[model samples]
Target: MSKHNVYKMSVASVYPLLVAKAEKKGRTKSEVDEIIRWLTGYSQEELEAQLKKQTDYENFFAEAPKLNPSRALIKGVICGVRVEDIEEPIMREIRYLDKLIDELAKGKAMDKILRK
Candidate 1:
């Protein structure tokens, strides 16, 4: 599938999966929210608004108030692709979020998950 198609995917569709991954590991929804906010700089209200709107990943990211600079430091393999090797900016951002969620699901410390 094309990157465009992936970008156009509804974040709402994936949100539950992320929540489930964390919950199954004894993490909370609020922790998932915190990871997202750390990555995208979205406040609780803004994040909830996006969730309620069922925003596509593209717009959810594009309209971000601020994407944290530390996101660039997130390095991992997601979907069999090394995030640092992704050439497209948008795809990299998407993978960065994926990686953060993966770390959260694995029970990494919140401080480490935030790349602090």
Candidate 2:
């Protein structure tokens, strides 16, 4: 899928897959949630609200309470592209989340995964 299609995809649709990705690797859903909250600055309640609203990723990041400035520290390739090298603002945020999820699934510790 093109980048635009990914941006338009609802978080609800994508969330389950994220959880499943972590779960398959023996990680818990809560870990995934933690990564998300850390990256997006979304409270647990607000994250659930967005999922229920079926918010697309573009709006999800767009409406995030605070996109953690530390997220810029996240680096690495996701889907064969280095996230830090992405020029588009929204796409960079999306890949930041993706990179975090990938790290979680790979058994990186919570503190390190959150860049804490």
Candidate 3:
């Protein structure tokens, strides 16, 4: 009588900790593979392909909006808010950012802003 194999599986990107523990216990990759095959039933190649295709950065950057500064800056001396009047530095930082953005909109070189 001949024995027939019914299922096949592959293991890729095994976690280092789990692999270490399994190795110490003398567990074969095929044992893990058989368990995974029974649980998820997904071919290892398919799982690997899906994992490789995952890209958080690509998705995040693709969905993010581009910022334009020309419409967002204010150049003239801003009043109503003074050093003593404003408690937080955040407002002051925003004013400075506005000035820089305005300068950039005017096509001024960054070096010019640094000099000012």
C-alpha RMSD in Å of predicted model 1 compared with the true structure: 1.5
Per-residue lDDT of model 2, residues 21-56, tens digit only: 999999999999988999888999999999999999
TM-scores for all predictions? 0.94, 0.95, 0.29
- Which ranges of candidate 2 are over 4 A from the true structure? 1-3
lDDT of each: 0.90, 0.92, 0.36
Task: Tell me, by TM-score, which candidate is best.
Answer: 2
* The 10-residue segment with the lowest total lDDT in model 2: 1-10
Model 3 spans > 4 angstroms off: 1-14, 51-116
Q: On residues 1-116, what C-alpha lDDT tens digit does candidate 3 reach at each position?
A: 33112101112222233345444555544444333332233366643453365423222123223322231232354444432344333344334433443344454554454332
Residue-wise C-alpha lDDT for candidate 1, range 1-116, written one tens digit per residue: 46678888888889999999999999999999999998889999999999899899999999999999988888889999999999888888889988999898898999999878
How badly does each model clash, as a count of residue pairs? 0, 0, 0
TM-score of 3: 0.29
Worst 10 contiguous positions by lDDT, candidate 3: 3-12
Scored against the true structure, residue 112 in model 2 reaches a CA lDDT of 91
